[model samples]
Target chain A: MRPLDTAYMWDLVPVIASYVPLTLFMAIVAMAAALTLGSALAIVRVLRVPVLDRIVAVFISFFRGTPLLVQLFLFYFGLPQVVPAMTGIDGVTAAIIGLTLHFSAYMAESIRGAILGVDRSQWEAAQSIGMTQGQLLRRIILPQAARTAAPTLMNYFIDMIKSTSLAFTLGVTEMMGAAQKEAAGSFLYLEAFLVVALFYWVIVETLSVGQRRLESSLGKAVAR
Target chain B: MSCQIEITGLVKRFGDNTVLNGIDLCLEPGERVAIIGPSGTGKSTILRCLNWLDKPDQGTIRMGDVTVDAARATKAQILALRRRTGFVFQNYALFANKTARGNITEGLTTVRGWSAEKAQAKADDILTQIGLADRGDSFPAAMSGGQQQRVGIGRAMALDADLMLFDEPTSALDPEWVGEVLDLIRRIADGRQTMLIVTHEMQFAREIADRVVFMEGGRIVEQGPPAQIFGNPQDDRTRAFLRRVG
Candidate 1:
C-alpha cells in the first residue's frame, strides 16, 4: 500500500468544502419541493376524492417500490427521450426533480398516517363547530399532523442528503461528483471517499439535533 | 332574539338499525335540558343529528330562523345552521396541537371573524371561568381529564353560542372529578345560555336540568320536568331504567 500524504489530504478539504453550497442547494430545493408535493398528495389521499385518490395511490406505490437510483435514471435519462423539452435541463435540475418525486411519495404516506392518527372525534367536533372541510384541515388538522410528520420528514431529508450523492451518476458535479473527480486524478480513493462520508455524517448529525429539538417541543404540547 | 331549538319527527337509521325514531321535543331559550338513555338508543345520535354530524332519516331541527330538515338539508344550509349551536363531546375533543387558549379562540377567530386580540380576551375570560386560567398555554394531553373538559367548555363558550350541547361530559371523568365538570356546566347553565345535555349522572340531571328527557329503544319513553321524570317517572321503562342506573 502507498504511504498516506497528510498535506495532500488536508488540501482537499477546502476543495471539497467549495461543493458544500451546491450539495446544500440541491437538498434544500428538493426538500421544499418534496414537502409541497407531498402535502398535496397527503390531502388528496385523506380526502379520498373519487378518481384522483386511485391515481395518487398508484403513483405512491410505483415511486416507493422502485429503487431511488433507478427512478433517478428514469427521470434524468428516460424522461428526456419522451419529452423534448426536458433535454435542455441540466443534470442538477433533473436530479432535484427526481429526488422530489421519489421522496414526496414516501412523505405523503407519512403525512397521511399522521393526519389519520388524530382522533376521529376531532372531525366530528370540527364539523359540529361549523368548520368547513377546508377550514377544519387548515386550522385544526394540519397543525397536529405536521407535528407527527415532522420527524419523518426530517429523516427523509437526511436520506435525501445521502441520496443526492447518487446524483453524481447523472453527471452533476456535486460533493460526491467532486470527490470522484479528485480521487480519479489523484488515485486516492480512500481519502476522497472518506471526506465525502464525513461530510454526510456531519450534515446528518446536525439535522438529527434539530429533529430532537422538534420532538421535545412536540412532547411539551402532548404528554405522550 | 329568541334562540329555542325545536326538533320534530327526528328519525335516523343506519341500515336496519334505527338510532333515533320520530323523536320530537321543544326546548325553550336558555332551557337546561338533559337527555338520559341506555346505550345504542341514539342518545348521542340525536345530539349529532341536531348539528347535522349524522344525517337523520327524517326530521326537522329549527334553530332561530334557520330550519334544517335533518333528512334533506343541503350541506351549505346545515353548516350555516350549526354555527348557532356549540357541541361538546364526552371525550373533551380539544385540538391536541393547540394550546388551551388556541383551542378556545380558533373558532371565534375563524368562524366569527373576531379579531385575534378580542378572541384571546374572550378565551382568557372563559378559561378563568372554567377554572383553567393558568393553564391557557397548556395543551390537552398536558392536562387531566377534568381540566381538559374545562378547556373544552371554554372552547365552546368562546363561541358565545346560543345553545351549548354537552354529550355526556361528566361520563368520561373519574368518579371524584365528575362533580367539578358538572358544577362548571351548572354555572354555565345559570348564566342563561341555552344548553342541551346528554348525561348518565342522574343526580346532576335531577339537580340542574330544567327538563329531563328519558329515551329507550330509540324513542323518548318519558319527557318532563326533572321532578316529574326523575322523581316520578310515568313509563315503566323509565322507572326500571332509573332504578337500574340509580
Candidate 2:
C-alpha cells in the first residue's frame, strides 16, 4: 500500500518459481488423468452405452454446472466426513481429484465433438475393410479424433494449469499458495502476487506457442 | 481364389422410404456387374447392402462360406462377410488423416493381422498398380480427386477382396478426372476381379460390365448381358433410362 516494492518483487520471483514445479506437477497429473477419463466418458456418450451413458451424462452435467471451488471443498472436506475411506486422503490428493473431475467434464464434450467431426465416410471406409467396431475405433476413429481434438485439448491443459492456482485453497503450497504465504509474512502482497501471476503468464504463453505449432502441423497434414 | 455372390429378397428402407425392394441377384465368380439407375433408384443402396454397410431390412447374402441373413446376421457373421469384400465409395473415402500407403496398409495390419512389413510391401505394390507409386506418402487432401480415387481403389485392391463393390466410384470426380478412374477400373476388370459397380457412365459400364442392370423405384427393371441390355433392351424402362443417360 505504501508503494510498489520493485526490488522485493524481483526477489520474490525465485521464491515463487520454486513452487512452479509443484503447480505444474499437479496440472500435469490432473491433465493426464482427465484426458484418460474424459476420453472414456466421451466414448460412452458417443456410443450411448445404455445405463452407463446416462450416468456419464449426469456426471458431466453436475461437474460442469457446479463451481470448481465448491467441488474442491466437497472433495477435501465434505468427502472425509461422509466417506470413511476418504478421511485419510490429503489436501494435494483432494485438489488433484477435484481438478480432474471438473476438467474432465469439459474435456469429454470436446473429445466427443471431435469424434463426431470425423467424416462419416471414414467410418464406412474402416468398416468396409472388415474392422469390428472396437477395431474401427482403435485403429481409425480415435487417432483421427485425437488429432482434431488436440488443439482444444492443449488449450484445456493450459486452462488447467491456471486453474491449479485454486489448489491453494486446499492448503497445498503450489505457486499461488507459496505467494500467499510469502506476502503474508513480509506484508508485500502486491509484489508476491505479481510474481506468481508472471509465472502463470509465462507458462501459458509457452503453451500457446506449442498450440500454434501443433495446429499448423495438423493443417499441413490436411492442407491441399 | 474368387467366390460367387448370391443376394436374395434384399430389402432396405429409411423410415417409410424404401431404398431397395426385393432385390435378387446372383454373380458368378469373377463377374463384372454394373448397376445403372437414376439417383434415388437404389443402385448405390444395393452395393452398400452387399457389404452390409447399409443393412438390409430383409434378405440373405451368401459369399462362399459366409451367409448373412439380413434379419439375423450376428456381428461376427457381418465381419466375416465384409472380410471377403471391399468397397470403393463415391466420394473417394480414403482415410483423410492417413497417407495413400497408410490407408492401404491399415486394413491389412489391423483387420487381417498382417505384419507391418508385409502390409507395407503389399501397399507399395498396390500404389504402383494404381499408378500412384510416387504419391504413397501424400495424404488424400493433398491429392487431386482422380489421384485420391485411385488411392481409394488401391486401398480396396490391397485387401485382395474376393468381391469388390464400387458405389459410384467416379461419380464425385471432375469430368477430366473421370476418365482416369474409369481407366483404372477397366484395368481391374481385366484382371477378372469379381465386382459390383454402381455407375452413371454408360459407355464405361458397357465396356467393363459382363452384365448390366437397370434399376428404378427401388426395383431392378431389367438385367442381362451387356450386349443384350445395351443393343436390344426388352424393358421399356431400361430403354428410357439408357436413352436419358445417353
Candidate 3:
C-alpha cells in the first residue's frame, strides 16, 4: 500500500544473507540423506525384494502423497505428543528428516526410472564378466544411472534449497525465519520477503549453471 | 588349456513359448563349434544359457569341474560358469561408460583381482592383439561397430576364458565392417580357442568352425564337420536352411 522501501530492502540483504549457510546446511544434509535413502529404495524396488519391497512401496507412497508441511508438523509437533521420549528431538533435525523423507520419495522413482533406463545388455555384459550383483551395480549400472539421474537429482536439490524455508514453521531460524522475524519487527513484510527471494534466486541460478556443467561432464562418454 | 563342455538336456521357456528344448551338446577340448539356424530357432538362447545369462528351465551344464543344474543353479555356481566362459554379443555390448582399455581391464581388476598395473598390461596387450592400441582410450560410442566388437573380443580375451561364446558377434556390424571382425575371429580360431559361435555368416562359420551345427525349432537338426553339413547335407531342414540363406 505504501511506497516500496528500496533502501530498506538493500539494508535487509545482509540480515537475510547471514542465514544462507543454515539454509544451505539443511538442504545439503537433506539432499545427501535423500540421495542415499532414495538409491536404496530404488534398488529394493528394482530387485523387488519380498516383504521389504512392499514396505518401501508404502513409505514412498505415503511420503509422496502427503504434503511436506503436514509431514514436518506431524513429525516435529505431533510426533513428540504421541511418543514423549521423542520430545527431545530438535527443530532442525525434524525439518531435515521431513525434507529427506519427502524428497526421497520423489527421488526414489526418478532414480528407479534411471536405473531401469540403463540397457539390459549392460547387465548381461557385467554378469558375463563374473561380476557379483554388488560389483555389477557398483561398477556398471550405478555409474550409468548416476549420469541419467544427475540433472533430475540436481533439480531436486535446488527445489530442496527453496523448500528449506519451511523449516521456519518448526521454529528453525533459517534464512526465511530470519526474514520473517525482521519483517515482523519492521512491518516492511514485502521488502524483507523480496530480499530473501533475491537471495534464493541467486543461489538457484548459480546452481543451475552448475547443473548444466554437471550434466555435460557426466554425459561425456554418452555423447554420440 | 581349453576346457570341455557337456550340456545335457538343456531347456528354456519364455512364458508359454519354448526357446531351447532338450538340447544336449558336447565339446572336445579346444573344439570350435558354430551354430547356424533361423532367427527364432533358439541359436542365441543356447549360448546365453551356457553363459547363464538366461536361466535355462531344465538341464545340467558341466564345464571343467563346475556343474550347474538348470532347476536350481546357485548364484555361486552361475558366477562360476560365467567366470569360465567369455561372451561376445551381437550388438557389441561394450560398457558404454568405459574406454576400450577399461572394458578389457574390468574383469581383470574386479573379478580376477589383479593389480591395476597388471590389468593395464593385459589390457594393453589385448589392445595390440585386437589392433586397436591407439583406440584403447576411446569410448564405445566413439568406435565403429567392428572396433567395438573387437574390444568385446579383447574383453573376453582378457579373461583367458576356457570357452568363448560368440552370439552373432558380427551380425550387428555394417557390411563393410563384417569382414574385419570375421577375420579377427578366424585368428582367434587359429589359436585353437574353444569357441561356440551362433552366426548367420555361413561362409565364415564354415571357414572357422571345426564342426557346424544346424538348429531349428529349438532343437539341433544336424551337426557335423563343415564339409559334411554344408557339402553333404544330412537333414531336409538343414539343407533348406542352407539353401534359403544362400
- The count of backbone overlaps in candidate 1 is 0
Score every model by TM-score.
0.93, 0.95, 0.97
Candidate 1 docking band = medium
lDDT of every predicted structure (CA atoms): 0.88, 0.91, 0.92
State which candidate, 2 or 3, has the greater TM-score. Answer: 3
Model 1 TM-score is 0.93
lDDT of 2 by residue, A1-224 (tens): 37888999988888888888888899999999999999999999999999999999999999999999999999999989989999988888998999999999999999999999988898999999998889888877898899888988998999999999998998899999999999899988888888889899999999899889989988776643
Give the number of the best model, judged by lDDT.
3
Instruction: State the weakest 10-residue window (summed lDDT) of model 1 chain A.
Output: A215-224
For candidate 2 chain A, the 10 contiguous residues with the lowest summed lDDT are A215-224
Report how far off residue B168 is in candidate 3 (Å).
Answer: 0.6
lDDT, candidate 3, A48-69, per-residue tens = 9999999999999999999999
- Candidate 3 per-residue lDDT, tens place, B21-110, comes to 899999988899999989999999999999988989999999989999999899989989999999999988888789999999999999
Quote the RMSD, in angstroms, for model 3.
Answer: 1.7
Residue A217 deviation, candidate 3, in Å? 3.4
**Candidate 3, which segments miss by more than 4 Å at Cα?**
B1-3
Question: Could you give the interface RMSD of each candidate, to one decimal?
Answer: 1.6, 1.6, 1.2
Off by over 4 Å in 1: A221-224, B1-3
Docking class of 2: medium
Ranked by DockQ, top first: 3, 2, 1
Supply candidate 3's per-residue lDDT for B130: 93
